[model samples]
Target: MMTLALQRLQNTFGYDSFRPPQDQVIEALLAGRDALVLMPTGGGKSLCYQLPALVRDGVGVVVSPLIALMEDQVRALSLLGIRAAFLNSTLDTESAWQVEGALRKGELDLLYIAPERLLQPRTLELLHHCRIALFAIDEAHCVSQWGHDFRPEYLKLSALHEQFPAVPRIALTATADARTRQEIIHRLGLEQAEVFVRGFDRPNIRYRITQKQNARSQLKRFLETEHPNDAGIVYCLSRRKVEETAQWLSDQGWTALPYHAGLSAEVRQAHQHRFLTEEGVVVVATIAFGMGIDKPNVRFVAHLDLPKSVEAYYQETGRAGRDGEPADAWMVYGLQDVIFLRQMLEGSDAGPEQKRIERQRLEAMLGLCEITTCRRQSLLAYFGESEHPPCGNCDTCLDPVETWDGTEAARKALSAVYRTGQRFGVSYVIDVLLGKTTEKVTANGHDRLSTFGIGTDLDLKAWRSLFRQLVARGLLEVDTEGYGALRLSAACRPLLKGEVCLELRQDKRQSGGRRRQVSTDQRLTLPQRELWEALRGLRRELAEQQDVPPYVIFHDATLLEMVQRQPGSLGQLAQVSGVGKSKLERYGDAFLEVLQAHRGDAADL
Candidate 1:
């Protein structure tokens, strides 16, 4: 059975071997055992259950959260010549009925359905009568109420286990902490399932967090340096911001689109479709845009505002570089973000216990943003893994941020806050410290205080950085009632006196030197570049003819391999990593023809 599974993996999925823990998870499910698979995004989590379903005796039923995700997976599978279908709201009644008929006739290998539809009595009755391979739940973290993507409907998924007691079940998620993991197990009734925890580290992604200073220009600078013509995601905290950023990027000559819940469903769907189907498109969106995004080539994920928690941040940024390529996770945050998030948290309807947990998560996220050590190490530590060395990719490791002793500076800043009655925001306090004789300052007569004009040495940017870091370090708190007034926290008393010294990273707002541009066609010669474009042209033509996404026809990685290897025959083409037996038999000759021309031209040259 295991050997057959491996053969199917190569013949159908077009891979020589399985990724780590995939083999184990597949073996368990093939042996009629359940599994709770915790793998990061782009970790090939789908194949853990997908390969087993093919090897098993019946159709695989996948419970997906998003209609777009289900459609994309089904399209990709169908391109591999698999008999896959999805029953979702996107389909008309007649089309859905046809899919149901296929399922009843055992003509489909896999069927993707939303949880709500699958939980219906009618769908359950139909499934009960069919030969059942297994139930695979994608994004299983949604089952946890504590998780950021919680769906109440997922709470009812326990019925799958109860009703299909004889069938194996596999639950998978990209991000889940210990608490959410336990919650998933309890809610999904997967206690007997073997748990597979893959490492949470996405080393290919470079993490960079900057203090917010003109976030729009900063994003542009980063984009120009890092991903000039590549696809990426820029996350914003609000719908208005999403629209504004998207328009701004568009004006800057990017193919940018806005996505948020505030947009009509039709617009959201259309925008998402474009993002998937087109190249060099950037989607500026809120958190609503990226739960099940399967786009593998996102080069960077930039955050204009802080996410609600570290898990949210991790998951959002994980959307980038799903292809295991070098990518970036960049963010810009300030004290205002802190105040905004705190206000949102306090205004929520969650109970005391839930609020407490959320507060801890927020604090952990803040710590990650402000950490002087390796960002990767701190991020992994939050998910309970610790021993990584300093990654030389993040801002701190790359530039080696310099820290200055800011004990007296902090005391002076705090004193200004106090002397100004602690009812002013950061700008007002900074103004007082810088001895700015504004109308409000003169009216308040705050320049008469001892701390006034005391912070002449530090620049405005430095003061902003100090205040932001203080909030991050929990030495300062935001007064919600006072409209984001900066107040000294109890923790600041140590620094207020001479009892403690504070070290802060010196504010350096410069962009790094231009990075080396990595192009997909870099390895190709001038002649090969022509062949690469020709090959891509053929792919786009075939995809358009078949009405599928170009990637569904062949991923950029696969096309690059074909170009590099210049395989001349079906046998040689089969050796390409992504060229499965079915695809080889169907499209091999056409691709081989292109390769042969390129090979001949190269020889002539």
Candidate 2:
């Protein structure tokens, strides 16, 4: 059975071997067992269940949460000649009926259905008539109430075991911490199942977090310099901001779209479709935009606002570079962002215990931005994977942050907050520090405070950075009920008494040089560039004809391999990764022609 599985892996999926625990997970399912898989976003989670479905007795029943995820997977499977179908609300009545009929006849090798549809009695009756190879639950993290994404529908998925007691099942997700993992196990009754916890580190993505100073122009420069023609996602905190940013990018001559819950479902679906099918398109959206996005070539994910937790940030940024190419997780945040998030969290309707947990998560996110260490290390540690070495790809690792002895500066900043009656926000406090006789400051008599004019040594940006860092360090807490007023925390007493010292990252002003940019990789020569363009043009042509995303034909990785290896024959083309028998036979000839022409051109040169 294992030999046949390996043969199918090579012949059907066009891979020489299995990536470590993928083989383990597949083996468990093939042996009539269950599994709980925690793999990274681009870590080939699909194949673990997909190949077993083919090797086992009957069709695979995959429960996918998103219609887009289901459609993307089914279309990619169809390219490989797999009999795949999906039943979702997006389907017309006739289409849904046809899919149901197909499932009844045992015609689908894999059937992707939403959780609600699968839970319906009519759907269960249909499933009872067919032989099911296994049940694969994608995005299983939704089952956890503690997770950032909590779906009540997922809480009812435990019925799959009760309904089909004998069939094997596999639950999969890309991001889950210790708490969420236990929640999934207990909820899904997968305690006896083999649990595979793969590393959560996406080494290909470079993490960069800087303060927000003119976020729009900063994003533009990053785009023009780092990702001139790449597809990406820019996340904002609000629906109105999403619209404004998307329209602004469009006005600046980019293909940008707005996506949020505020838009009509049709508009949201249409924008998502265009973003998937087209190249060099950027979608500015709220957190509603990135779950289960399978686009492998997103070059960057920029955050105009801070996410609520590390998991949200990790999962959102994980949407980029799914093909394992070099990508960026860039963000710009300020003290106002901190205040805004605190106010939002405090105003939520969650119970006290839940609110406490969320507050810890929020503080952890702030700590990640403020820490002057390896970001990947801290991020993985948050997910309870602390054994990784320094990734050397984040902002601090590449261009190390410089720290200054700011004990006096910290004391002065703290004193200014205290002497001003602790009733004012950051701007008013800064005015008192700089001794600016703003009408409000003078009216309040704060201009006569002893801390006045003490901060003239530093500029406005430095003062803001210091205060943000103070809030991050818990030395100062934002008054959630009031209008973003600062209050010194109990943790600040020792520092205020001069019993402890403080060091802070020096917030340097941006010059013409700005942040150090990792020079973009230049792999293609003059001849290779022409061939690359021709190959991409051919891919776009074929994808448009089929009305599917270009990646379904071949990922950017496979095409780069084609350009580098210069495959001459169909047999040689088949050796490139991602070229299975069906794809080799379907697309091999055309890609081979392009490669052959490129070789001819290079020979002439």
Candidate 3:
């Protein structure tokens, strides 16, 4: 059975083997054992249950949350010559009935359905009659109340195990903390299930968090300088922001589209389809768009606003660099973002205990943002894992930041805040420091403060950094509601009176020369460039042909690596970092042919 599954994986999935934990999970499922699979976003979590579904004696039932995901998965499975169908709200009565007919006739090998649909009395009756080999739950973290994208309907899915106690169940998610993991096991009644936890280290994605200042321009610079003509997602916090950013990016000559909950269903689907099918298109969206999006060549994931928690941040950033090539997880945040997020939590009707737990989660996220250590290490540690010596790929690891004694500056800033009655925003405080005599400053009579203009030695940007660091360090608190006035925290008292010294890491700008620019002259030349384009064309064609993401064939970095190495044979091609045995066997000859043609031209020269 295992050998047949492996053969099917090679011949059908176009890969010779399973990713790290996939085989183990598949074996457990095939043995009629329940399992919990925790893998990173780019990891092959789908194959664990997918292969088992194909190999099992009866039809496999997959419960997914999103409609788009259901469609994409069913389409992908069907393209592989597997009989698969989905029953979702998008299907009309007749279409859904047709799927039911298929299910009854045992014509479908895999069936995808939404959680709500699966829990319906009629659907449950139908499922009880059918011979279900295994029940698979994707995005299983949504079952946890502590998770950001919690769905109350998922709580009903436990009935599946209740009804068919003998059928094996497998749950999978890309981002789940320890709390969520425990919750999934308890809620799904899978306490005895075999659990597989993969490493959370996304070494290929360069993690970075910049203080939000002129975010649009920063994003523009990042796209123009680092990832010109590359595909990416620019995540915003609001529908308006998504539209505005998409329009701005389009005006700047990028193939950009807006996607959010507010758009019509047709428009949203169109935009998402365009983003997936078209290359070099940027999708400006809220958190609604990322789950189950299998686009593999996304070069970057940029956050224009801070996410609600580290889990959401990790999952969203995980969307990039899925093909194990070099990608970036760039985020711009500020003091206001913290306040905005807290305000959202406060505005929720959830219980006080739930609110308290959420606050702690947000605080933990803030700690991640503020930590001076390696960003990747800090992130992994949050998920109850650790990386030694830190990943040398993130911004913090690539450029070691410097710290200076900000004791005096903190004292001055605190004194100014105290003198101004601790009721002003950052801009007002800055005006007081610069002695600008702005209307608001004068109207509030902050100009008359004794500590006014004491920070003239530092520029406006420096003062802003000091303020942001103070907030990040918990020396100051921004009121969640209202205009976000800065208030002194308990930690500020000691620093204000000089009883304790405070140190702040010099901002990324002050550290200088860390951001690398791709030089035009060092770029690929002549036939190499031509070959690179041809390889990319082939990748797109193969991606469409296979109905998988393009990067799954080969990443741009791998292509460039191939162009540079010009590997002459399959063995030489397998030496490339991303090229495993399966990929080498499948694509090695085509690439070698391209390289050989180029080599002939080089010899002629």
RMSD for all candidates, in order, please: 1.7, 1.9, 4.0
- Which of candidates 2 and 3 is the stronger one according to lDDT? 2
lDDT of 2 by residue, 79-126 (tens): 899999999888999999999888888888999999999899988998
> What CA RMSD would candidate 2 show?
1.9
lDDT (tens digit, per residue) of candidate 1 on 1-605? 89999999999978999889999999999999999999989999989988888999999999999886787788889878888999988899999999999999999889999999999999999999899999999999888777788889999999998899999999999888899989999999989999999999998888988888888989998888768888999999899999999999999999999999899888998899888877789999998899988888888899999998889999999999888778889999988898899878877899999989998899999998888888999988888888888877777787677889988888888888888998999999999889899999989988788878899998888898888888888888887574888888899988887898999878776665345435566767888789889898988788777766677777778888887778877999899988898888878999888888878887897
lDDT of 3 by residue, 1-605 (tens): 77877876765675657877788888899889999999998788888888888888889998988887677667656655678999989999999999999898888889998899999899999987788879999999889887877889989888988899999999999999888899999999998899999998887788988778888888888887788888899999989999999999999999999999899988998788777766888999999988878877788999999888999999999998777767889988887787778678877888998888887788878877777779988899889887456787777777777788988888888888878888878888888888888888888887788877888988988898888778767788777567778888897787766688887877765222245533322487886787787777887888777666566577666788888888887777777756655566667787788778878878888
How many steric overlaps does candidate 1 have?
0
Cα shift from native, residue 508, model 1 (Å): 0.5
**lDDT against true structure, model 1:** 0.88
Worst 10 residues of 2 by lDDT: 511-520
265 Cα displacement, candidate 2 (Å): 1.6
* Cα-based lDDT at residue 127, candidate 2: 90
Candidate 2: segments with Cα more than 4 A from true spot: 511-521
CA displacement after TM-score superposition, residue 512 of candidate 2 (Å): 7.2
Query: How displaced is residue 3 in candidate 3, in Å?
Result: 3.5
